[model samples]
Target chain A: MDLLPQLTQYAFSGLSTGAIYALIGLGFAIIYNSTGIINFAQGEFVMLGGVLTHFFLMVLKFPLVVSMAVAILVATAIGVAFERLTIRPLKRPTPLSMVIITIGGSIFIRGVAMLIWGKDTHSLPPFSGNEPLVIAGATVMPQHLWIFGLTLLVIAANKYFFYYTISGKAMRACSYNRTAASLVGIDVRRMVFLSFAISSAMGAMAGIIIAPLTMTAYDVGVMLGLKGFCAAIIGGMSSGFGTVLGGLLLGLLESLGAGLISSGYKDAIAFIILLLILFIRPQGLFSKAQTERV
Target chain B: MKRFVFSCSLFVLILTCSALCGASQPIKIGALFSVTGPPSFLGEPERNAAQMVADSINKSGGIKGRQVQLISYDTGGDATKAVQLANRLIKDDKVVAIIGPSTTGETMAVMPVVEKAGVPLISCAAGRKITEPVNRWVFKTAQNDNLAVAKIYEYLQKKKLNRVALLTVSDGFGSSGREQLKAQAATHGISVLYDETYGPKDTDMTAQLTKIRGTQAQALICWGTNPGPAVVARNAKQLGLKMPLFMSHGVSSKKFIELAGDAAEGVMLPSGKVIVADVLPDSDPQKKWLMAFVKEYQKLHKVEGDHFGGHAWDAMMLLKGALEKGDDLPATIAANLEKSRAFHGIGGSFTYTPVDHAGLAKDAFVLVEVKNRDWVLVK
Candidate 1:
């Protein structure tokens, strides 16, 4: 009944939702870093993950874990196809053209998804049962723990991959200086494709994982993607840690605002506060010591 | 020139002869429903219901031996398209009356067009604004939101649950219901202790629920369509917020139950009698009509007669009853429809007065509880 318990509940819920946004923000970050093009279809990949899993689980009668894995793979394949079919073979493509193409790609994906799944909302069974774990009167769902555990694990894996692995080094090098990396005999094109593949899988996994907590529908991607992009912008787009912070900040602000102020003005108040916070460090909440300005 | 004049005179004579014979023109009804969009779930069944009713009417030799023709256009949940369709139905088809435009947004959009054209429009949307101004030619079959609020408040008063928390979606349906909920609560001797809202597309509602849990409220009322309300149900369950949860009729569908799964158990909402048609007592006036509708609709679509379809059935029946009582002229039909009181149809028993174009009574809603993923009548 105390203020502490209510605050804890809001903060915990916010962080859990923020973790999903962080995964989506990372998807944006990876695609942006490698190609300098915002893959507007990031949210659609998440939708595809959730919807395809539902299709596999309910219609095809596949086991849940297998269906989830297959869903992730399918989304990843679509990412490869998207990059290869739309942007790869372009000759002297303009920046405006690339932007339009990605936007068009997102719409196309949504249209196709509608035909396949209709406009109905779907959900996945929770990894654990529905009961929440209560701590000193605060509550958290089992799915939240799943999200936090998996997101932290993925972030750690990504950090290790980028710092130590040859492919990750090549990806980082490509982002740093594309032409120079290409001159040094790195397959810059391959790195770009790899980034798309990885980010697409991540987005889809986030969709599948968060869907148990949140209902998934054909048209949910647009709002989710827009919020994730906001998180990416507020967290330095270049830093993984900053992206997580940005996602957490956005989620917490929204939750706290909705709880304390008028729920109707939740988004408005949060965005105003976001604008104020960004006024201090326009670069973002966190900035890498040395960053090439895009 | 002489031959041309003779041909014209012959055509005029034949037209006059057919007009005298009384089998010349079929009674045309224009229907606009969102058959393929986000609100398509509402429109598809409505379209089916209208077509089924017209077919049966024509098979029974229609009113005064004239065939009944149903002309429907899918609005696809777009307000612009609904307006365009309303114009076409009025100016082109020359229908005596019009039914539907499915959702609240579309019905509100087409109201001006139908009112200006002087055709009786029976809208299937739940927004109170649809008929609040009492457009002379406009009426609605769907129960007004205030009635649903009344239904909930009536239950609250009976249970002596005086204080409640309110969570509404920040959309048209939710906002209107929010106003009505607040306005109607005081009359029922209830106080809204906490009022909250969430985005229509918001994925989490726990924080708001957590705040409501801290309030001295006896129950929570969530006003939203599917997905958001479903998430709230799950969130409330996970947070162990055991206070009774009441949802708006916006989520009166199997979709919400499916989305919420086990979490939907014990959730209550005020819904049309269509969902519990089979369970109604034989002594009830609407049971026979509701069952007939259920049989006919299921025979055609293989699905149970739902709330949306029930709205269409009521409109069609109202128009038929009106046409039988009055002439086919638009004004006469409008007058007849207004005179229609204590009329039994699937949605509810409608009683229209000059001031109230929103025709259904508070009895239109039945308090239903979710049990094992199906609606069970509570009262």
Candidate 2:
């Protein structure tokens, strides 16, 4: 393995992980854009997707595709319920309070997950198989391809949802001005509900695709969630390609940094990049600086 | 005045009687385990094994006609909590000896407290530092990371695989194993080609493994607990790396095999003899004891006895041996444990001494490879 091959392998692996980060970051962006609250429990939805799929497939003996679909649906259901129970019921909602609530919800869901699934790490079989596909002396598992393909599919779906669909446009309206959107009969509350459902479903799908490679557990959400949040921040909380790019960049930097610099500082490199981005480009690299009128 | 003097004499007599009765009371042994946290796989089995041993001992007419009482606390794998719990066990519970704190970090944190309190602590964690420098009051049942390193090196020596890549977790267990791997490389006629680390919560190690693939190393040794090393094994397999992948004793459990699935095939690790007890010849001293413990643990806990539980079983039985021979005093138990010689129990035949508290040697571990998702003793 020469330097080029090694670097190529690193980039390939990084892109796979970056795709996951992008998916998770999109979840954070969706909720943030609509509700103005960071869904800290967004990561839990990812965990729930993987674990629930494992449960459905391994425990309940459901087929793989059925398990995946049900897992995503369950996670989306929970997301909608979360919006209804926590976000919508806030008599006096503040950004800090809502964020704290999401954090609390994340911990609660993790605890319940532990009790139900267990603390042991569980792995799902790869969707196709575990065969290696080589390209230019770099090898990747079939699951990596699944990650790339599904990430692109979800990003496309997300674009279509937010741009072409009426509900998505209404959701965008809610993001801009919930009061005005509601005044115009857009049903701001329903738009908020749709955003949670979409983001959580997307997040669950991300978790399912990656579970084969990374494995899943009740507490896996913490780090993945934090990393996804970082992705969202790097993308300046964009709901589309910006977040995807942010995720890819993060994954590539993490993988490359671990390979070239030192594996010991792999996570450190990620956090350092995050800090730099926050310092230099407060509004993120892609998103335009906004001027809001009161 | 005569009646008052008589009553005082009677009170003295009663106090002496109560003190004499206290001698027949059950011996209290304290245990600290991370029985419900991330390391619960280690701590849960240990706690269960200790309880099982205590119960069986009591069933067999007690330890020298006095019942044994095991007082266990869940440390939650936290070092600070372990120290606080250790203090409670020593000061409030007044146990004769302590069995665990499950993990190395917790055991190390609780070591100074036990030393100050003069309670003998037989830890279940495997970090060499737990028993290094020969702390008089601190001992461990898990084989030293140095011994595991030696076992791997010995195998490498036989296979003529000198150059190796080291990937260790940046935590207490991995760092300790990494240090030993580096320090003992020369002795075993091996050289390290690449040394890398990953966080405990890291999801992937393809980048690290890919770099190792680029190196001139003939073999790879990953030191970490479940999930992390499992991920490494999968990544290596994905890259089609033909080099033999070695793992430290940290992941010597069936859980690792299950987690890694097919990727676990061909992965080798140094493990306590407990996991391979049935395959051991009857001539082996620890076989009978190991078999009996496995059966008893399964019956009691409904789970197979792995290396971690075997550590607790060893700790509890070693303490029992000391208690049966000596009186119920911390000093007596410590002295008795120090005198332990060729005690054939699970985790190997432990021979404790005044100087060497870890007791087990390199032979405490046997190199085993995963074949068809089962541990096969490596020839």
Candidate 3:
């Protein structure tokens, strides 16, 4: 194997994994921007997506597309219910308190999922086929293409929603200044609710697309959620294209490091880069530093 | 207040009466299994099988007309938790003997606790270190990992595949297997071209496999539990790596086939004969026992029996035999276990001496392959 093809293989696999992180990072960024709180339960939504789709397809014998849609919809519903049940009831919710609540919700959801689905991992069939396409001595799965294309489409739609739609504009306003946004007659609570809905749906979609390659289980969310959080931190939680770039960079570094260095240090490479970015560029690689944080 | 005092006195009197009258107390035994965490696949079946054995013993009128009482705890695959639970079982439960602490790491963690307490433990984990140094109180039923590696290497040698790549998980089972693979490579006339490790929770192994693809290795041997090895299989297929793939006994179950999907096809491994019990000839001494256990376990759990459950069955049955032959005291049971010879069990026939705690030989393992999503004994 020549160095070039090997590098190409690394980059190709990295980009697909990066796309998953980007999806999850985008979810974290959305909820953070809207409610000024990091929802740790964001990962559970991703787990729900894959597990529910698996249940629908394998157990219920539903078609792939219908199973995916129902899974995403149910996850979004759970997101909304989570907000109504856990988040909206707080009388004086501090940022730390809300973060802790999300962590609790994450554990609760994970436990319930474990009870419903056994500890064994479940795999989803690849959307296209199992055959790999070779380009310039590098092999790529059809699922990777699906991941790349879907991630791009998602980012573009997210951009349109946040910039062009009125509700999305109002959510941004809440992120900027909640009191001011409420004073201007925008229903801030609705924006917060909407943010949860959008993020959970996005997270589930990401889980579904990546399930074929990574295999899905109840506990996979912990590592993946932390990695997405790293991506969000690296991208400065921009809720835009910044997080996408952050994920791509993290994935590539991890792959190349594993290939060139020792595979044992693969996970360490991600954390090292995360710590370096936090120390050097806390605002993230792609986001502009904000003058004030709400 | 007067009525409450009278009732308390009455309760104490009844307790004393029952204690005095109950001469034939049940024999208490403790078990520790990782029933719910990452390694639950190994632990769940093991727990079920152990419980099944205990129930059957009690049903048939337990050791010396004393009913057997099994107290099982779930360690969740955590070594620290295993140690804590071991203390609770020994000090609080007052169990004469202990079984399990499912994985090698947990088994190793609890070994000192059992040794200090003078309790005999028959672990289900396959790591060689569990019984290698021959702790006074510890024995295991699973075949040593060196035997599994030797079985694999012999097959590889027969195929003339001299050079191989190794990918292992960096946990107890894997690190132990990696050590055995490295140690026994020379005598088997095989050389390792590349060696790499991935975390137990890692989702991808393409990077590691890609590095192996660059090597002159003719085959890749992966040693790890489910999901990790499954990912390696998928990654190898995605990379179109045209080399034979071999796996450790950690993945001798159907769950591995389901997790890896199509990638599991043509994957070969070394496994306990319990996995291929149905195909074994009648002349095989262990075949009848294996078939009976497979049927009984499936009837109870409604699932196919694998090597993991077989390990627990061996441990419990070994303990039962000792209890039936000797006094119910831990010391006597330990002595009885040591005196055992040519005792047939699921993993293999055991012949425990004072020197060798893990009594099975290299022939305990048979080479098996995954074909069409089922295990086929390689001829």
Candidate 4:
């Protein structure tokens, strides 16, 4: 009946969006850390998850669960292929060239998707149902819950992989010291490829979960990718925890700013905060400043 | 002497045949639309509708014994690209006239180029600015944003809904629409209690709607094309806002209904007769034209034609009429178009004067509502 419920409603909405951004940020962090390339196609993998799933569910008449898993797998394969076809063949490129290749790859992927699925926006019905459950007078759709739950699961899984599993640890080591890790027989290139595959899988999962709320279209990857990349940079490009925090903060700030100030200024508000953070906390909020070896 | 005479006769026959082929060369119409970007819902239909009109006209016997040749380029809703394509159409393809450069942004962007090139450009975009300044080379078939605003206010006055909130996108189309909305608000006795603008690519607009909910507005008018307006409808229903919702002509498509789902029910918008083709009286001038277009468009695209498509149909039909009335020269064709009067097309009867290049009347729009997820004529 008052401001509290409204604020809570905005907060819930913010959290749901934050979950998607976190997933995207997590993808950005993994790829950026491992290969030092900001994979612009990271968002496209997420986009492919939704676009391919929509195609499967609507056109192919595939069952929901199968379509989803297949979408994720398809996106993962595309990400792996992106590395193989675009990244690997460049034989010894300058860092800027690699970044440009990813950008080109993103544009190419988008154009292909546009051809397959025309530029109109397509939507999937919410998983379970569309009805909202009221909590403390704030309406929350079941899809929001799905997004939140999946995001936490992804984060926990990534933590376990990086901390406890050998493959993830090797990938982390490659990011930390590629030359040293290669000397210690880490197979740095293989780790880089694995990181791309893993992060792409995460992005695909995010797309699938969020597609029900935010409809999918061919050109959605560009802006969403930019936001995720911003979140990653703000969260400390190297720290997974910081990336998640950054994504959530960006989402919350954007939502609250929109609600309180103006929707027109919401994007500007987020970017200004990012710029301020970049200027002040260049090493990122939660990241430890690692000194470069001379 | 016999061999030389035979060669001279053969060369004369070849020259005559070459002249005949050149006479029947089709009129080139440059077509530009977003086709593959955010606003493709508007551009794709315009592209398809223009092509359909061209194909049917040629089939019914070529215009002036010449087929219509359409050289279409996908602008992807980018203004800079539209300008480049316009130049290419003028310089490279050498189209006699340009039909579209879909969104208002692209239309405005390419206006100067088309004007400077001295080529006729009949835009499928609805920004009033296209024709207001009256560029000698530019014309438009899309109803002016102000005319659409007037149509909405006419319905609102009848309903006695005075206080309204306006939410528009921050693109050229929305900005221009906002100007009309504000400029005409006082004239219509509609007090805009809350005004808001949103990003074109934004997926959600609940924050703006929430702020509007706090106002004493009797109705809400959300002006945007495709996904943005659809999102507003969904968000309004999600928040259970009690105020009646209205939309601009931009969301006059089945795509909006599909995206908004149940949320689209009872939401009104001012659109053309394309959606209500079956319901129109047989004697109505627009009926036959609308029926023919709907049949051809549905047959081709496997979807219903919206107002965006109608805009293209009108523009192409106008250009076709001009081409038919005048010679292939661009200046003559532009003059013939300026002389258009009582030419009934899909949108409405058009009358163009030297001062007014856009031919459609203010009554071009009809108020329609999404009832049971279908476009229903509002009585």
**Per candidate, chain B TM-score?**
0.91, 0.92, 0.93, 0.89
Candidate 3: which docking quality band? medium
Per-candidate TM-score, chain A: 0.94, 0.96, 0.97, 0.95
Candidate No. with top lDDT: 3
CA lDDT of every candidate: 0.87, 0.89, 0.90, 0.84
- Itemize residue pairs with steric clashes in candidate 3: none
Candidate maximizing TM-score: 3
Docking class of 4: medium
Q: lDDT by residue for model 1 over A98-196, one digit each (tens)?
A: 878989999999999988888788988888888889866778888889988887887788888777899888888887888999999999889989998
What DockQ, on C-alphas, does every prediction get?
Answer: 0.64, 0.69, 0.77, 0.55
Which digits, one per residue and each the tens of the lDDT, describe model 3 over residues B1-379? 9999999999999999987886799899899999988778888989899889889998998878988889999999899999999999999999999999788889989999999999999998877788879998999998888889999999989999999999999988889899999999999999999999999888888888988999999999999987899999999999988999999998888889999989999999999898899888788888988999999999988997777888888989888888888799899999999988888788999999999999898768889999988999998
Which sections of candidate 2 miss by over 4 Å?
A289-294, B1-23
DockQ of 1: 0.64
TM-score against truth, every candidate: 0.92, 0.94, 0.95, 0.91
- Screening candidate 2 with a backbone cut-off below 3 angstroms (N, C-alpha, C), the clashing residue pairs are none
Weakest 10 consecutive residues of candidate 3 chain B by summed lDDT: B124-133
- Candidate 4 regions with alpha-carbon error over 4 angstroms: A90-95, A238-240, A289-294, B1-40, B64-67, B71-96, B105-119, B135-137, B323-331
Supply the global lDDT for candidate 4: 0.84
> What is the Å distance of residue B191 in model 3 from its true position?
1.6
| B354 Cα displacement, candidate 2 (Å) | 1.1
All candidates: CA RMSD (Å): 4.5, 5.1, 2.3, 4.3
The TM-score obtained by chain A of candidate 4 when compared with the true chain A: 0.95
Q: lDDT of candidate 2? A: 0.89
